[model samples]
Target: MSLTSVEALTQVRARTLALVAHLDDADLERQVDPLMSPLVWDLAHIAAYEDLWLVHRYAGEALLHPDLAARYDAFETPRSVRGEIELLDAPGAREYLRDVRDRTLQAINGRGPDGVLHEMVARHELQHTETMRQAMRLGGLLAPGEPHLDPLTGPDGWLDVPAGAFAMGAPDGAFSYDNERPRHDVEVGAFRIARRPVTNGTWLSFTEGGGYQRREWWSDEGWAWKEDYDITHCPDAEAGHPDAPVCHVSWFEADAFARWSGGRLPTEAEWERAATWSQGTDPLQAVGQVWEWTSSWFGGYPGFVAHPYREYSEVFFGRSYRVLRGGSWATDSRLATTTFRNWDLPQRRQIFAGVRLAADPEVN
Candidate 1:
């Protein structure tokens, strides 16, 4: 059953808090890497985001912590400097979350609330929860526990998608980011996509066979990044399984692996078409396990218009960022809808990401 807007918001808030429940002051405050903020900062930032959307934008109310806006605003303060900023203490951040949620509840219950905005805010928190987990995983703060991956699934090989036309992107009135808007028809040639994502075992084969040393397999920029970072393996390789879809694989790594495996990364449209088909007889497995890199760059749909704020999606539409589909283990299941566009630097391997290969129908 679909949750009431209030229920969804409440549940997302609960999950956000639960994610950080055991972490104490020091852990929450520590910045594990420059790419991510301190966990406590994330907590406050979540609160601040809710306050911005719910209390300020939706409710048209006075700011609760207006003074802290400069500090907590994501664009105003980038991740590189977040660790140095003096943010609310862990307990204080929790209190801020509660306070913001209290106001959010009032806003949603008072008048006919814009359920779409409520959903957007709820999903925003959900995304942040995943971000917080990324920080936890990287910081070695998470306790030893079972991974979310399942054993190998689906048919042993490829799923063929015939040459055809299909409507791409989410339709109007749906709950999706602006990047997924302006649904349009697209034509693609016949291709075969993997039944399952490329697993750690497959990736390990590449690395063991000197995949990193073989410069020919990597793009010029990709090889440069590999050598610059001295990156040799995924972050948690010791804990990974041959069956589990690889995590922490960057677009560069995914591309190189695809080349080594005699395939290529699927374009965003192909990925979407396959995902749409996955719903029926043409089943695709191991989705929502890790964000799958696509061969497409992050760009606006043809008729894209920035809704509410340009900062959300418009700012990042460009060649510098590569598109990723699916959702990671830490992702809230609801947010992994087919058209939800995710983008990051091609060289960023810190986020939980994996690869899926595609090739011409005749190749296999």
Candidate 2:
């Protein structure tokens, strides 16, 4: 049990608790949004998940709440039904967290090489903290971030990533998701990429430029989704944060913006190249503010194999999902590495996501 794990576990708990400190029992139990789970659900889910992995799986012990495991399993209990199900109340949930943490610390001392699993578990809690914040923000329980008094701006010019190949995924040195495994090299062509994610004010330019009305700027499916949802303004733009990165945007919205601006979204490969380039004259700015949508679909790299479990990555490899690069403000630092891949359906926007523009170099 390294001190690092202990610190991470303790620190993340404090952060999660602080995020919900202002909310009462009803706020924690409320569904908030159809797309998000109740805050209480997220709290108990974190504890149950940690106990499953650390206390039972790693420590070779019985689960503290064996009967409750099914209730917290994310896949088994989808977000839509979490609020309707029997779950621990806010007080019980908090008690569950403390009980689970006590056992996890014991596992740290009485254990196998628990560091990797600890990292995975800690990151899981970190991620759900963000998920809880999503619910809080939707329900008006969480306060907005610092206001952007002026329009958002970044480095004045786009970066030129010259054609080259580089290692494109996580290496064996640290803890990474199975999807980021087996680091490999890949080629990318010369392209121009924005130094910062598109801001709320800038995205307004697209919306007011008839981006939604102009069918030419959107794909057939994107257009259908736009029309179906009666979509109009970007969420952050409507929220009065003009200088912040435009958030809560779906992939369809991002692609339409890219097309309207005569630019394109970067493939995950191009995104990684720009983010990881060593001889770079400049680096992308304000990356962690929002999860930048990528043009790439979610899939495995060459010779990709599932580790720990197949459900984490293997089940979602298909065109049904678009890959997102860069981490959002809600993303944990440990899970925000350049190689980390976040994916969702093209039309989903509940998560904190934004866009960065890219384009091919002009052929002369």
Candidates' TM-scores? 0.96, 0.95
| Location of the lowest summed lDDT over 10 successive residues in candidate 1 | 142-151
Residue 9 accuracy (lDDT) in model 2: 83
Give all candidate RMSDs, comma-separated.
Answer: 1.6, 1.9
Candidate topping TM-score: 1
Model 2 C-alpha lDDT per residue in residues 159-278, reported as the tens digit of each score? 888999999999887888989978998988899898878877888888888877988988999989989989877767666566678888999999999988889999999999999986
Candidate 2 TM-score, C-alpha based: 0.95
lDDT of 1: 0.86
Model 1, 1-364: lDDT tens per residue? 1788888887888888777777789999889999899999988998898898888987899879999998999999999999987889888998998898888888877865677888888898899888888888788876456348766766768888998989999977668888998899999999999989987787888988988899889999999999999988775554687787888888998999999999999999999999897445557787888899999999998988998799998898877999999898778888988889889999987778889899889754
Reference-based lDDT, residue 351, model 1: 79
